[model samples]
Target chain A: MSHRARSPSTALRPTRRALLAGLGAGAASAFGLARLARADAPPPSGTAVLLCFFPGGWDQLLLLDPRDPSRFTASEAARTRIDPRYDELVGLGYRPELVRPRAAPAMVLGPLAERPGAAVQLTDFAGRMAVVRGVDMRSVSHEVATRYFLTTEFPRGSLAQGSSVSTTLTALARPARPVAHLSLGVESYNDRHPSRWSALRVTSADDLLATLCPAGAVDPVLADALDAYAREARADVYNRRGLVDRLQGARAVARGLDRDDVSRPFRALVDDGPENDALRARFGISRGDFDGPRARAAMAALALTSGLSQVVIASVAPAMDTHFVGNAGHARLLGEGLDAFVALLDALRTTAHPEGGSHLDHTTVLAFSEFARTPLYNTYGGRDHHSAGSCLLLGRGVRGGVVAGATSDVGMVAVPWDLTRGGASPSGTVLTPAHVAATVAAAAGLDPTAFDAPPISQVLV
Target chain B: MGRAPRRLDAGQLRASLLHATGATWTGDRRVRTNNDPSGYALRPATDLVRHYASALGEPDYGATTEPDLDPGPGFLRRAQSAAQGACRDGLRRDREVPAGARRLLRAVSDGDTYARAPEAVRANIVALGRTFWIRNLSPDGPEVEALLGVFRAVTEREGALPADGWFAVCVALATDPQFLLY
Candidate 1:
C-alpha cells in the first residue's frame, strides 16, 4: 500500500497508464455516486417498507397533534403563538367543524384527515395505526433532526457509522434481487453498504423501466471481443492483488444477470402495457399528480411487482417551513402530496400479490417528517420548528388503528404514552427515534435486541 | 493450482481493448487509476448500463472511502453489479466505436497487436500469450494456432472487410481462460 504505482504490467503490451496520459483530457464537466454503514444483522422477510417522507418539519397541530377550538381562541391563537425566532402563528383558517373525529378512542382530526367520503379519515386503520406522540427529537435543527429521525443514532457523531432503516431492511430482505434497494427521489444515505448493495437512484417511472431493457439487439462480434478481453485482463488482475477481491464480487453480479433472459420480462413494464396503464390510472398517475408523490409511489409499485427491487423509498417536500405569508400550504400538501399517497394506498389495495395477498397486504408504508412544526406560529405568520412530533404508517402487518403516546393541549407538549397499551400514561417513557428503528426492525423480522430500543409492540401484529 | 479469475475493472478493460486492437490509445493514465465513477455508465448513478459493475466485482473506485483509490483497496462493504454489464458495454463498443478508433482498429496490421497476419500470426499469438496470459507460447504453439483458426473463420464471415479477422484474433487472445481468472 505504499505510494507504489500499479506494478508495471511486465506484459509486452504497451503500458496502459502511460499511454492514457499521452492522450490529452478530452471534453468531459467531470461527473459525479449507497452502501449501508451498520453492522447489525436484520433477518429477511417477505414484508417490505415504503417510506413516504414529508420534509420541512411538518405541522403537528394540524396533522398529528390536534388541539381544541377553545385552545385556539382567535385573539390568543393569532397573536400569542410565538417561537423563539419571534415568528407568529398564522390564524387557524380551517372551519372548526372541519376537524373530524379519528377512529382512535379520544383522538380527533385536522384538515388533512380526509377519508374516502366521510368514513372518518384514519379511523379504519385505528386498530392498527399506532401514533407515538410526545417524541423529544432533542434538537429543532433541520439537518440534524432529519438525520436523527432516519438513522436513529444521534447525528452528532454517527456520520461514518450510521445506516438508515430503509438500507438495513434492504440488506436483510433482498440479498439477491437484481436491484435490491431502489430510491426514487428519497433523501437516502448509503455510507457503509457495499457498492454492490448500493441503491439504484431513479427520478421517474420511465427511467426505472428503461434501465432494465436494452437499446436493441447486442452484437456477437462485440460480445466475443469483450469476452476475450475479460479473459485476458481477468488473469493479470488476480496477481495485481490490491483490487482483485472487489473485481471478483462484481463478476459474480454480472454472471447472475441474464441480459436477454432477465430483462426480457421487463418489456411489459416499459411499453405502456394495459396492466401498467390501468394500475397507473388507479394510482392517480393519469392526473398531474404523476409528477407529484404519486409518481414515486407508482415506481415503487412497479419495482415491487416486477421483482426489480425489494425496498422502494419515495419522498415529497411540503415546504412546511412556513415562516412567511402562507400557512395554508400545508393544507395544499394534504390535498396534493398527501392525497397522492392515499391513491397509492388504494392502488396497492387493489393490486394482487403473486404469493397470495394483495401488495398492500404485504407492503408497509411508513410516513413521517423530519420534525414537527411549532404548535404556535411565530411573528412570520407561520409555525416554527418544534422537537415534539408524531408519524403515520399503513399497510399489511402494521397495526393501523390506534394512536400511540400523547401531547399537551397548550404548548403541544408531548405527554408520555405507554407502549403496551398505546395510550397516554404518566409512567411511560418519552418515545425516541430508537423506538421507531426498533419498530421497523421488528416488523421486518430482525432480532429486536440488535437495536438499542424496543418496538412499539402495541402496533405490531 | 488454478485460481479464480480476477475481474478486471473498467480502467483495465478499456486499456486492454485499446492495446489488443493496436489503437495508439495506450490508456496508461486510465489503466493505473480510474478516471471517475461518472465516466462509467454502469452502477446506480447512470441511467444507462445496469447489472455489470457489481457482478464483476469492479470496485467503484468512487464508492471507496478514501478520496483517492488506494492500490490496496478492500471490499467497499457491499456487492455491485459489474461482470455482465462490462461484457455488454465492451462488445457493444465494437459495433459502435468512435469513427477514429474504428479506423485505427481496421489499420491494425501488426501481428504483435492482433496476431491475424499469416507472416506473424504465430508471433502475434505468442505476444498476446505473454502480455495477456502472462506466459509464453512455443513455436507452432497450440494457443497461437487456435487464435489463427478463429481469425480464418471471422475473415471469411466479413469477406468485404477482411480486416475484421483481426477482431477474432483480438477476441480469442482476450477471452483466453488463462487470461480471465485472477
Candidate 2:
C-alpha cells in the first residue's frame, strides 16, 4: 500500500491556507506594505539588523564546541562527538560569494583530541568573548523568563510586563517613522510590546495590502451607516475609558488604509522585483507555500529593503523545541533554519536599499532566545532548559567568528568573564537578562540605562 | 495511499521532544531502551507528559482514566473522548467560579492558554478560571504556548486586571500553557 493509504485524510490535506484565512482581520492587518515615505533620516550611525528569536531554550554546547576532553563531563561526552566541521564554523567568517553550497566551509578554532566515541576541540573565540553566567532571573517559568528576556522586566501580575528592548530602542532611536517596529510573523509574549513600539505586523501577502493601502471611500450608504456606528462606539469607549493612545494608533493605522502607493500588496511588490526570483529559489518557497517562516522572512526582507520599516522581527514556524530527538532534529531545524536565516542576511547584505545604498553595512542580525539546554541527555534523549544560553551576533559592526562565552566539558559549566562590570560566568559573577537587552539597546544607539540596565560593554563597539 | 508513519528515528524523536518540552538529557549515559538498543520507541503522549511535568515541577494533571470511561480500540478516538469528558468536567468547575474570578481567569487564559484549554473553560471561564484551564491542560508545554503566539497575548492582557487576584493567574497560565498543550 502507498504511504498515503495508511494516513488519516486530515494528515494528507494541507491545513495552512485555511489557518491563514481564519486569522482575524485585526491579526492580518498587522503587516503593512513596503513603502519609502521619506521621514527624518536615521542618526548618522543608524544601524538596522534582524533579531531572530528561538522561543525555546537552545543547546549552546552543540552549536559552540569546547575542545578539551578534560573539560568534558561524563554527560557531555555525546557533544564531543559533534562533526568537527561545526567546530571549524567557530573561526569561519562570512563567505558572501558562495551560492550553491548552503553553508560556508567550517573553520576549526582549536585542536581536537578523541576519547572513545567523543572528540574534544579548542578555540580562542571564547577568550575575547564575554559570557556572563549563573544570572538568577526572578522566575524560572518559561513565560516569565521570556518576558524578562525581551522586556527586561520581571513578569508581574499584569500581562504588559514592559516594552521590549527592541521596541524601546526603536522608539528612542526613530520616533518619526510610521512602522518603527515591524513584526513579520506571529508576535511573541502576551504583552503589547509590539504595539507599544508602534510595530506593524505583516505575516502574509494579504496583510501587506490591508495595512499600506489608502482607504477608498466606501459605498456612500454603507459608509454612512458604518460611520454612525463607529462614532457611537468610539464615543462610548474613548470618552469613558481615556484610551487616547489606542485611538491615535488606530487613527494612524486607518490613515494608511486605501492610500494608493501604500495599498499595493506584497504580491505586486515582489512579482517582478529584482529579488523576487532569487528569494523564491533561495528559500525554496512557492506562491502556494507563502505562509511559512521562509516565506515570511523573504517577505520581511523585501519590506526592509523597500524602507517600509526600520526594525523587523520575523518568527519562523515549525517549533525548534526538540526533546526526544537530539542532534539530528536540532541540526536540521535550528542549524538549517539558522543557515537559511544567514542566507537571508547575505541576500539582504547584497541587495541595495530602494534609496540606493546597501542595507548590509547598516543592518545587524542578532539571533537569541530565553535560555539554553542542560548538559545531560534525558532518559528520552532530550535536553532540559538551563538559564545560560548562547546568542549569535552577526553584522558589519559585530565582531565575527568569535564565541562570546565559555562552556565546560559537560556543557553545564559557564566560564567566567570579568570584562563588563557585572559580566561573569556560571561559576563566578552573575549576569541578568537586562544586561543582554542593554547591549542590544546600546548597539542601536538607545540609552541602555533608560531601562535601568547597563549595556554589555564588551559586545558593543 | 497510506503514508508510512513519520516514525521517530531515535535522533529525530529525541530532537523533537527536546525542542517541544525544553527538556535536556545529560549525565553518564548509555542509550538503554525497553526495546532494542538501536530501535527506540516513541513514548506514549501520556508518558511524555508525565516526564515533562515532573521536570517542570508541575502537578500531575493527566486525564482521569476510569474503566467506566474507556471508549476502546483506537488511541486517537479514546483521546478525543477523554478530551470531551475533560471539557464536561471543566464546565462543572467553571459554573462554581465567581464572575470576578472568571474575568480574572479570562485575562490569564487569553491566547495560548485559552486555545489549549478544554472548550468548557475557553467558553465559560473568566480570569482565574481561564488560567486554571491552562494549568490543567498543558503544564509541561510552555513553549507550545509561545509557538502558538498566545503567551504574549495573555501577558498583554494581564495588565488590564486588578492586582490582588492577578499574580496567581499569571503563574497559573505560565505553568498551565506548558502542562496543557503537550
Candidate 3:
C-alpha cells in the first residue's frame, strides 16, 4: 500500500542452507539441487514472470475479441434491426461475405474463426488462459499506448514514466540470483531500483557469450605492469572515497568472473552445439533465429534453470506497425507468432522444477500490445489504430477460460462491463490499463497499489 | 598527467597495447563489418571484448533498428563486464606471437638499441609511458624509474623469452588507470 520501493538488503542474502530447507520437507532434489546448496530460494508457489510483447497494434476483431456473427445471416437487414450498428458495418470494411466466424465454445475467438488451424496448439491449454477484450487504452498513438500499457503511469508527462511491469517483477524476484533480469532485445524502463538489480541485457546468445567471456588476457609481464601502476595510481585519488569504492566493487566482480570454476558455466552456455539442439527445438527455433521470440523463449528457459537470471523480457514477433499490409498481414504474423508462443508455453510446461509441478505451474505470462485496430478497414486496406485493446494472461494462479469486458459493434470502442458482483445487477467497471497492470503486478509478488489501478481479483486464483 | 577513470574496459586495454608500443597489425585481416555500428574495427580479442553488436545466432527481428536492440545510441556506453582477473593472462604466457612483440619493442626503443638487450631500455620506457598515458612523459618521475626497474627484473627472469618481459612491462603501463581511463 505504501509508495516505498522494496529493498531486500536487510534480509540475509539467501543462504544455501535456507534454500534446501525451503525446497520443502519432501523434495529437495527437484532439479538435482541436493548437492548444489543454493540458499534463500522462493517457496514452491513462487512465480516467474514472462512479458511477451508484439509491436504495433493488434486487430482484436481478427484475434482475441471477435464480434458475434449470429446476428446476420438469413436476413441481413433483420440482424441490424435488432442491433442497428451491424447494418452500418457495411459502409466500413466489415465484409459479412468474407468474414467467417467459427464456433468456439463460450469465448469470442478470432484467429481460429477465419482459419480453423490458426494457433491450434493453444486449444489444448486454453483452459489455463484468460482474455479481457474491452480495455480502454486511453491513447491510440503507438508510442504513448506502448509506454502506458507497460508502465501504468499516465501518458500526460514524458518523464513521469516509472519502472515497467517487466522491470518491477524482475526486481521483485529472488535477489540472490547471479543474473536477475535478462532483457533479450527488449526495450524497458526502470526508475530508481537498486543499482545491481538493474536489468542485464543481451540481444542474442552470442551477446550473452560476449558478455561472459573476456578477450584474451593481457601479457603476464604486462599484467604486472598494470597491477603495479594501478596500486600507485590509487593514492593520488584515495581521497575520493566514492570513486575508490566503485573501482574496488567493479574489480571485485571482475575478480570473481576470472576464476575458471566460476566462469566456466557461463562460457559453456555461450557456445552452442548439438547439446542445445533440443532447446532450439523446444522454442521452435527451426532455422535458429536467436533474435526471434523463439530465441527469447529458449534463452529464458536457460536463464531460469541455470540460476543465472529470474525475470526474462522478450518479444514474440515484430513489424506490427502494419499501415501497409492490413488484416492479411496482421493475421499472417499473429498466426505464426502465436504458434511460436504456444511452443514457448509447451517448453515452459516441460521444464522440471525441484519442487513438484512443471516450470509453467510456477511461471506467469503476459502477452500484450499497445492497442487494437480500427473495426473498419482504412483506405489503404489496412486498419487504423484504435483505443480498445485486448490482453492475455496465463500460467500459475490465473483463473483460466474466462473472458472479461466487451466492445461496441459500431466503432469497436470498449464498452463498460461489470467487474465485481454481489449487490448490483451488473458490476459495470471499465477495465483500464492500470487494472490490467495491477493484476499482473499482484501475481508477481509486488504491491499493486503502487500503481493507479487496484488488482482485478476476479482473474487471480 | 592523472587518472582517466577507476578502470578501463578490455577494449581500451587492447588499444593501449597497440598504441603505446606503436605496434602495427600488418596482416590486414579486417575483422569489422563494413557497416558495423560500433566504430572500432574488431580484433579476435576485441570482438570478444565489445558489447553485443551483430553477434552470431541473433535473429533479424526488426525491419527498423537494424543490427537490433537500439544499438546505436548506447554504442559508446557499454558497461564494464570486466571479469576481474579472468583476463589477467589474456595474451597467454605460452603462445608465441613473436613478430608483433618484436616490432613493438623496436618501435618503443631508440634506434639501434632495440636489438641489443639493456641498451634501449630507458628510452623505450619514456616512449611507451608517453603514448600509453596519451601525454608527455618525464624520465625523472619516480613512476617511470619504478617501471624501468620492473622491466629489467622481468627481462632477467624471462631468459628464454626475454622479449615477453618487455611486452609484460608494456602491459603494466597500458593497464594503469591513467592509461585505461582517458
Candidate 4:
C-alpha cells in the first residue's frame, strides 16, 4: 500500500530559486527545494527525533501504568508502586497514569487509563502532539519488527530491511560535513543502505582521516607511489560510475578545509575548545568518559550543531527485550539505562553552538522502542510481545501537558484507540510505523508520499 | 659369555631412525631446548628427541654445550656421526638406567602414556640409543627388538607410551640447520 496524494502544501516555484541564490547555495542545497533559503537561513530549523528502540517488544503495561490494578493483578500488587514523578505530572494537571521524569523539559504524554495498548503525550515545544495507537506490525521477530518500525514495511522487503527514517531523510536532504547523517556506536543494520546521500557511518573521527590518507607513515618515495596509485584507483571508480560530480565535490570539500566556516566546528571539538568543553560539561561527560556509544553521540551532536550533518542516528546497546524475568530485574535494567539516556539528551539540548547559541529550540527529539511489551504478566513472570506501544516526541514544535490516547480494561487486551469511530478509544486504532516515518519525512520538507505513507496528522503542527 | 657386538654406519643408523618416525626435516642447525626450541609452544619432534636422549643417559644432545657447527647442508651428516658415537659408547658403558627413564618406558608399554615430549628431544634420544644398539649390540638385529628391553621397562611403569615417541627418528633428521630454516 502506497500513499497516492502529492503534498499540496509544497509548491515548486522558480522565484524561490532566485531568492535562494541571493541567500546562498549551501543553505539552499542543505534545506532541500521546499524552503526559502536565506544567507542567514536560521540553520534549517527542524526536529531532531531519536527513535530509542528496544528491539524486542517492551511491556507497555508496565511502562505506561505500573499500578493499573486490573493489569498488575493482586499477586503483583506488592511489586507495583506509584512513580514519584507522577505527582509532579499531576501538579501540572496531567494524569498520573504513567511515571514520567521528575525534571523533564516537558510531559506531553501519560497513561491512557481506558486504552490498553497505546499511550501518548503533548510537549511544550509547540501545538504539535501525538498519541499513536494500535500499530500492527507483520512480523513477531525482533529483527523484522525493528526494520518495519524504522522503514514502515513489514517483513521488510530486502531494500527496506535495514533502512531507518534518519537514513531516508538524510538521503533526501543532503546536508554538508557535520550535519549530514551520523550513526553513533554500533549502528543498526538498516543504516548501511547504499541509496542514502549523507555520509552516515563513522566508527571514529580519527578513522576518517586515516582512510583518506594511509601513506602518512611511509617514506617519501613510497608515499608518492602509493598516492599516485590511490588517485588512479579513485579516478577509475569515478569514471566507471560517471560520478565525476561527486568526485569533484569531494575534492572541493578537501580543498575547502582551510576555510573558516567549514573547519570551525571540527576544530572546536577535536581541539577541545571552550565550546566543546562546555558541551561536554552540560552532558555530564568529560573527554576521558567517552565510550563507543557516548563518543558517537558527542561527535554527532558536535556535527549537527556545527552544520556538518542534518541528521544523526545514534543507538545504545539493546536492553528492552526482557524475556525470563519480569518487573524487578529486566524492567529496572531498562528503566535505569533509559533514565541515563534521557539525561544525556537533555544535556545535549543545553549544549550551545561555538558561537554561543542553543540547539534546544531548533532540535526535535523523538524517542521510542521497537514496540511495547505484552498487556498481561505471562507464565514467565514477564510480558510477551505486544503490537501496541508508546513514543515520546519532545521539542519546540510539541504541545505540552496533553495525553493523547485513552486507556481502559478490556478483559485481557488494551488497544490504542477506538476502533468504532477512528478516534480515541480504549483499544487504539492501528497506527503503523510507516505513519511515524511519514511524519518525520514531512517535517524535513519532503513529500511523505515519496515514502508511500501519510504523516500522522496528530503529531504535525 | 657375551657375543662381540656388530658395528653400523652413523648415516645408515640416522636414516633408519628417521624412517621409523614420520616427520619432515626442515634444515636448521638449532639445538632444541624448552626455551626457544621450534619457535612455537608445542614442537612434537623436539620434545620426543629430548625424552629419548634423557632416557638413554646420553649427553644432552639438545644442549648448546657444543660449539655451533657451520650448520651447512652437512650438519645432518655430522649429527648422525655424533649420535652413532654416543650410542656405541652408551651401550658399552651399560650405565645404570634412571628411575624416570624406566617409568617412561613402562608407561609406554602399558598403553597408559604416549610420550608427549617435544619431537626433537625424543628423536635425538631414541636415535642415540638405536645407533648404540646397532653399532655395539647387533648390526643385523631388529632395532625395535634390540630396544624392546628398555622400552618395556619404561612403559610398564608409565603405562602406554606417548604417541610422540614414534617421531624420534624424524626429529633427529630435522636437527640440521637446513631442515629448520626456510
Number of the predicted model whose lDDT against the real structure is largest: 3
After TM-score superposition, the amount by which residue A273's alpha carbon in candidate 2 deviates from its true location, in angstroms, is 9.8
lDDT of 3 by residue, A258-330 (tens): 2211122222222355434444545556443545666666666555554455577676765477776655566
Model-by-model lDDT, in order? 0.50, 0.41, 0.53, 0.39
Model 2's CAPRI class is incorrect
Give the per-residue lDDT digits (tens) of candidate 1, residues A1-461: 11012222223323432332211111000000001111121222377677777767777766566665554655675454522221122233344333444556555655456533432234454544556567778878776777788777777642323666676777666445666766665434544454444455544444444334322213344334443443334334354442444344433333333232234222323334454454445445542232346667656655554445567777643445665544465555654555556655654565555566666677767778778887665666666788887887667656755567677655777777788766778998788877876776676565565456888887676
Q: How many backbone clashes does candidate 4 have?
A: 110
For lDDT, candidate 1 versus 3, the one ahead is 3
Candidate 2's residue-wise lDDT over A10-105, tens digit each? 232334222322212211122222232223222223566466666566555554333333345344467653222222222332221111111212
Model 4's C-alpha root-mean-square deviation from the true structure amounts to 25.5
Instruction: Name the regions of candidate 2 deviating beyond 4 angstroms.
Output: A1-45, A64-141, A157-160, A188-196, A214-244, A263-265, A268-276, A353-357, A401-416, A419-429, B1-182
Q: What are the chain A TM-scores for all the models, listed individually?
A: 0.73, 0.68, 0.73, 0.62
Candidate 1 matches the true fold with a TM-score of: 0.62
The CA lDDT at B40 in model 4 is 17
Ranking by TM-score: 3, 1, 2, 4
Selected candidate, larger lDDT, 3 vs 4: 3
Candidate 2 chain A least-lDDT 10 residues = A113-122
Q: For residues A173-240, what per-residue lDDT tens digits would candidate 4 score against the true structure? A: 65544224555432332333332232334344332221122111112222122223223222222233
